[model samples]
Target chain A: MKTPLIDNLQYANFSPAIFEQMRAGGVDAVHVTIAYHETFREMVLNLERWNRWFEDHPDLIFKGTTAADVSLAQKTGRTAIFFGFQNPSPIEDDIGLVEICHQLGIRFMQLTYNNQSLLATGCYEDDDTGLTRMGRAVVTEMNRVGMVIDMSHSGERSTLEAIDHSTRPIAITHANPHWWHVALRNKSDAVLKALSGAGGMLGFSVYPHHLAGGSDCTLDSFCAMIAEAAARYGAEHLGIGTDLCQDQPDSIVEWMRVGRWTKGIDYGEGSASNAGFPPMPSWFNDNRDFGNIRTGLLNAGLEIAQVDGIMGGNWHRFYQQGFGPA
Target chain B: MKTPLIDNLQYANFSPAIFEQMRAGGVDAVHVTIAYHETFREMVLNLERWNRWFEDHPDLIFKGTTAADVSLAQKTGRTAIFFGFQNPSPIEDDIGLVEICHQLGIRFMQLTYNNQSLLATGCYEDDDTGLTRMGRAVVTEMNRVGMVIDMSHSGERSTLEAIDHSTRPIAITHANPHWWHVALRNKSDAVLKALSGAGGMLGFSVYPHHLAGGSDCTLDSFCAMIAEAAARYGAEHLGIGTDLCQDQPDSIVEWMRVGRWTKGIDYGEGSASNAGFPPMPSWFNDNRDFGNIRTGLLNAGLEIAQVDGIMGGNWHRFYQQGFGPA
Candidate 1:
């Protein structure tokens, strides 16, 4: 089979069109964000809605629970949509819900989003208090249940502590090297090194805001950054998790950042003038443009095997290793 | 360990005082009703509150997740509080929540209370539709997850269908036999026979409204009724689920019967004259009075083994067999 093309993160305004595009792009699997600052019930409702979508678009996409589903999706010519939570709000304060959410096909969960959560301090928190008591317990449970702990949007201290606490390899599913671009959401080289050293994966983000030149970043520059990271860390631990927020309404940013916690709008990273999804780079606008990334990586002097691994084979291997009872 | 005292059902006005009473009564465990007619989020909030209670009163109580917890509670000199739901509202429309509720330590859940629900028909429904499509899926999921299906307040046909459909033995956790009292909420002879015949349990109710003489019923008479049931259904499948709704405000009954489904009060089973909680029988009023019934059973000519099994041993064994993946 052709090397599986997987994007480790996306929170698209899902529709039949998106599923069709996923199939068109030959994307074998996509870790779709199903919850951000949603309560448990609300998250279930979101799953229910996705269930409807799966039923409505069976030919184009299928719900993925195991790593085997990626190959199944490839065999069936469909995209395996793996569920993930951008924030741990779906579990709320309940530790037991970690397994419950896993049982419901949630393959990944972040301890925090962009602010302080019950579990840990988010990237936006000034104090960075690290993992809470509940956070430690939840990490144990998550590791036991095979729910990948994604510290993509968590503060540095909490992220490092989570790495130390979790017995299983975790992931920074969507972020870039802060050495390349000093975005708050990007990971420091020390954090990235610690993560990769512990056999964890780093899914380089294509979310413009984390890019060195934002939306105007060139394909050559992006690929060069990936090449540098591959040389620094190992290419086996590198993959793409394009933090695509395709076709979302501008208003959803408020819900994503503020949720029910605030009466006033909190524009995270983006200000009032640009409080919406930033423009995609000219080289990659949607799932269909993933081929450009493959070509760009090769043009940046990476060998075929390393480029193939960075494209999706690494994530497919990670999924096989991580998405099961530890 | 010394005839383990277990109340199969209760919706008490829970406080530290109640926990103290449970320990004072030497109750090993209690299947306390945590949700009547709550949505999934509301039910989670209730669990969160119970988690606090477990934290605050660890000396008197602990959250019970398995039958082993009964012996643990006995060894620790604390009551194990097992959770139940009097209605399926906690799951709402998602069948996935069956395992979720089980993970959160909810051991039992009624298909319906005193009105028509998404799962099955309650006793008050003129037309008993039995289990819906979602109901069958939920039942199978519940059985798989080891969440006991309690048809205590469900209609006859629905109760029978549930028993027939469920691969694992189900329970009528809080109802007396209609042959003895003829109350609307009591189980019929056919249900009791079918239940116990199929390895299910019949938890005899101590709620005054289901008693032959209401609040005036003697302990001897109640025990005699249980003795009769033992003679009919065998002593091993008999237990007590008092339905002890103690210390709750009169206004709370409205929420129990109507929930958010209706704008007006539903004086279900009880008339307007008797809308609130009926007074408990003089013999058994609170958790502290469980010993009275135990003594009354011995006085009513039950063998020590039969009496002990009827008290709690049967339920404990049932818990062992029932609370795991079937």
Candidate 2:
């Protein structure tokens, strides 16, 4: 069978139309962000929405809890949607919520978004304190329960600390290399090296702000960057996350940035001149364009086997290896 | 392989001591009430406490999610603690919370708890309007999701409505027959008949207020009453719930009856002369005394199989048949 197509991260304004696009693209699995800056109760409300969607369109998509669910969806000709969080707000101050979120099928959780969380410092913070007292407890609990610690939006120190502290392999689920892109959201070489060296993964992002040329970055440029990342950090640990925020309202990005943390707007990743979600590169706008990425990776002097693994095989193995009890 | 000792209802001030008592009593499983008047968030806090207990005492007790857990608990020499709610307050006004609560291992939820909740009228309400619109929706959702719809403290009309409304067999997890007990918490004859006719269970409660003569009632009286209930509703429809609120302070009863609803004390099920929890029956005070009831049932002239069913076999069958997706 063709390699199962998986997007390690997405935060779409989900609907049946998008689900249909997933099937049309042969996408077996997509880790969808159910909470950005939501509290535990608010995160439950988001899950309720997904539950409704799953009930309404059982033939289109289903909630995926294990790596085997990808194969199940593939055999059934449907897409499996896994749940995740973009920030630690969903867990709030409670370390118990780490297991609770895992029980609810939250496979990935970023410790920080763009500011200091109760657990760790975000990339936007001036001082880079690694992990708080609660952060260490939460990391051990998350490791015990099989929830991946994603540090895509976390500070450099916090990311490195989490990699060393976690007993299980972690992931920077949707970040490019800082050397490839001069963006605060991208990962530094040290973070990437520590992550990959520890059997972790680095999913290359297609989100404009994390790309070299923003929305104008070409398919060749993106894939060649992935080829370079594979060379630096072994092809087995490289995959695609895309950081796709498909069809979401611009106001959502504001919530992702400013959720109850401040009384004023922060305008994350954008300024007054461009204060909204940037357009996607022409070659990759939706799920249907995963083929462009696969073709581009092949043209970037990567072997067919490497391209297949980068597309989704690597992530499928990661899901199998780490998304369960330690 | 003796019949599993399962208490279908409890709200004890749980600890290692109580769990030790459960082991001494040879209890295999318990349906523990995790909420009374708690909101969804507050109920979660209660679950977090239980999570801590389960973590700390895995050898003595563990969280039970399925009927098979009873057998597992028996094999492992531990008590499996199943979760339930005595009121609809945990779900608030959201029907979606039914499925979410079920997913979180909530096996049972009451429609009301001695007041006019958003779902249905409680036994304490003046006018019995039966099931509200939301109550109907919640019952169907609960049925679909394998959560037992419990109406142990509901009004006659509301209980009858629930018995008819739910496709799966509902339960009165902790109440005696009103004809025998003359208490507001007890089920009326019609409610009991309908419940039994629909293959439901009536877990006889030993709470002092629900007894024929309160704390003065004898073990023979309780066992004889169980015999009469078996004559009317068959032995396959009976079990013991006990409602053992062991080691709880009197203040906990106040919270159960008047939680944030009234500014002044309501003195539920008690007179002004005695405004706290009444003494439990002399023959039954804690988990270690279940053996007395088993012996009393046999002396009350029940066959061994009939007595065994009343102990826990009936509820085990009900759990296996009902606690899964319809």
Candidate 3:
């Protein structure tokens, strides 16, 4: 069987058209986050809406719990929607809430948004003390609940401390390596080693700002970076978390910049316009569809098997280990 | 200068005597789980207790967020304690709680305990569904918050999904490879490969049951396994997440058996405990002390630098990437 296309990561506004686009792209599954600055209640409402959307568009979307589910969805001509959270804000004070939300079908969770919180420090934190006692409790609880802990926007100290404290494997859902591009968003070689040592996965994002060449980046450059990482780490350890923010409203950008839905950060206002960055070339914008990732991989000279693994096989195998047929 | 003895994993009931022993053993740092099903709440409630303990026992313990912190602690005649969690229950449903807890010094988080939860599947679960929708959210929020996602007890699917979903590096705090012993408790070759691809860490535990020869297992046997993994994935991709449940009550055995705080698994409840299981051998029990890992590594004829990494240096470097400055 041909390896299915698995986009390990994506962040996009939901709509029927998008769902159809996902199906058109032959994307077996996509990791979708729900928690932002929205309150837990609001997040839940959104989750219900998405769940209902999936229910209404059964032909277009299927809820995925394992890699097998993605494969199954593909076989059945559907898109697997793997749910996640971009922020931990929804789970406010009670660590037990991690389990509750987890049970509710929120798969991936980032520890912070842009600013610091009670748990570990955030990427923007001027001072980071790593994970706190409650943060440690949250890690253990996450492990207990079988939730995947992510550290894309987290501060260095918190991320490392969380890695040490966790008894299981962890991941960096969508990030670039600092070795390729120096910035808070990029991970260091040491970090990669530690994560790989623990049997974790690193998903690369297609965010231009995080790229080595900045706004002047292209799919070829991205592929080169991935190839280098594969040479250093191995293709099996690498995958794609596209981090595509398609159909996202400008308000969402404002929310991201402000650090909260209602309040804004000191340095930036509503939305830090990306207009300064080179506009997405026509091909690139149209390529935002998940199918293009497969085409991109093929164009990069990646074998079909390799592409499959990066697209979804690796994730499927991973899911089998954690959540196979009971 | 001689490399300091660092315990990558340890879970002895905290006490002044233990701290003193660690100090006398020339230990540089330790990854201490702040949450366990048995003492989950106690650990959270007594955060100040640990902080106070570190404060009063400056000669013995210091808080650590990076490898440098451990080195600094060692230079200052102190043991660096990296706060960790064995579960994710503390965060409850709110992703924001991740940040809250991270701020308090919690560093690492394991996705599940022994059974199913909201995020992913566990090793003990009959069906490992990998990362749930909520699990994916946990991974994403963890990425944003900087908390490390751990999958030692997580099912295979969830582990891989977490790897695929994360944007930073991850870790497996404590686990043995199925290549060493094919048990649910062990990781598969594919999992290890994926982990290396992500540039993560694998902290091998000294759990007796996980050894090939069971109770007769020795430090040399453990080293052999580590060597095998290192040969396959490189030494830098390995570390130690010794699942030392030192000083834990017998209830812990029951807890481990059936995912209960005070009860055993239905099958384990009535059956006579396996002779080679549970209590482990006296040697293994006494060897739970973090200091012994170094001696055992030396006894197994590992290189000093290799031992240093397994002991804690590798983990320290990992922390530097995950967490920022202490």
Candidate 4:
């Protein structure tokens, strides 16, 4: 098989153009966030919209329900779109809906976004009470139904609880190590160690705020961080989840951060001076620029196998293992 | 609290008259088969129709999503209608739909109807292949999502495998012991032994074909059979599933057996001479006659507690244990 190229997470402004760019980048599969704060019915409506997209764009993209679909996309020269949720709002109070969303091809879901939820505490919360009663049950249900738990936006205590409680591996689909960049969203060495120790993959993020020097972060520096992660946690556990919010309107950031919970603006990552999507680094602007990272990793002293694994091979393997019943 | 009276399974041509009969019968809850061979989308339409029924008949009936709803219905003096499937066709080939149907309040789903399905072999299939690859996975998913695996219409080997594989107790939502009646649809002693031994429940079927004397089967004899079952298996494993098909048109029988799979008609339990639904036994012709069985059981020398367990308490307890994550 041609080394499969997969991006574990992205909440992109998806359109035919973005799909075409995925094809241009030789990307076989992309896990896309289909829900942030949408209710179950609203998430279903979003799925309906995606169903229409699949029907409309058969040659460009196909809905992927399993990791095997990655190879299918590679052979057919199309992109396999895997659905995910940035928050557990779609499931609401019902744990039964975890399987329903998984059935609808949602392969991943975060227990928390940026606050306390029925399941877990989020990163911004002052005290992380960890996984709630419902959260623990939902995790077992999700594991049984082959849905991966993503703790990217969850607090440390909650994330640790999830990694320990989940019988199957859980992921942090988009974030860097706090050791590299001291952002609240970035994970600690302890979390990453426990994650990889439990066989879970960590997809390094390319969001501007997650980078060391903001939007001015160099490709060499980013690749160097990857090499360090590989040295510490083993190369097989590393992958990419570019956190790309491309072509989105500034208003969407407000909806993403505030949803319907607050009346005032909550500028996430971006302050009042820059309250929207920060400019993406020139080196990796869109799906078509994925090759730049591969080249940068090769120049940053990574072996070809390690670089290939980080690019997509690792995720392809993870998808194969994670997208089915344990 | 009055002991909740719940029927484990029924498929009737429901109307306001039936609701009135349920009220008169004092039935607190009932597991109603919503799909025979319908696909997931088609099953959803059936649920929508049921939703309208709940809205239209609020005084007589309400939708039951949990065991607590049974008590709610008792307090409200209306029957709580619990959804189920007589066959796994609603989920088709996807293991994910087990949870989706559960989310829609479906409590029981049979592995097969009267022929081989993707998951398991039906009673009518000559060769029993047991659980298919998808069937094993679906069982775990069902176990996780709290959807009961029903083997009422499935073949012996497949039924045994399901009992073995499911960590949670499985159910035969509507079927009788073959020792009582030689109908192929009736389960064998081996199957019942395995079922009850594994903490599973066996809901006795009252359909004419599965009874010793067909439509003339007496309440005394039916209660005597229950007494025998209680001797063989614990009373905790027994409940009423009636298999009542009241007021259904003849065309529905054909649809239930054949669906869209074949153009020709299938007689199912009814032979060429007695096609369509056999006349219901006189002692239990409708929901209003449930009290007759209760009296008969009392007359048949069973304790009040055992009779109550056989009537509904067993299923009420099952609903409590079986409707949540293990």
> Among these predicted structures, which one has the highest TM-score?
2
DockQ of 4: 0.03
lDDT of 2 by residue, A1-326 (tens): 66788999998888899999999999999999988888899999999999999889999999999999999998999999999998989898898888888878999999999898888999999999999999999999988889999999999999999999999999998989999888888988998999999999999889999988999998888888898998999999999898888898988988888988899988888988889999999998999999999889889999999988989999999999889988
Angstrom error of the Cα, residue A45, model 2: value is 1.5
Q: In model 4 chain A, where is the ten-residue run with the lowest total lDDT?
A: A94-103
| Per-residue lDDT of model 3, residues B1-326, tens digit only | 55656556677667887777766666777888777553333445546466557547877787776567877886788888887776777666655556545645777888887667767787777888788888888787677656788888788888898888887778888889998877777899998888878988898876666667765776667777787787788777788776666677765555455544444344331246552135544445533355555677677667878877776677777777786421
Candidate 2's error at B249, in angstroms? 0.4
lDDT by residue for model 2 (B60-105), tens: 9999999999999999999999999999898998988888898889
Which regions of candidate 3 fall more than 4 Å away from where they truly are? Answer: A259-262, A266-278, A281-283, A286-292, A295-303, A323-326, B1-326
Candidate 3 whole-model C-alpha lDDT, 0 to 1: 0.71
Q: What tier of docking accuracy does candidate 4 attain?
A: incorrect
Please state the error at residue A274 of candidate 2 in Å: 1.8
Per-residue CA lDDT of model 4 for A103-144, tens digit only, reads: 568899999998899999999899999999999999998898
DockQ of each: 0.09, 0.65, 0.02, 0.03
Clash pairs, candidate 1, are: none
Per-prediction TM-score, chain A only?
A: 0.99, 0.99, 0.89, 0.99
lDDT of 1 by residue, A155-194 (tens): 9999999999999999999999999999999999999999
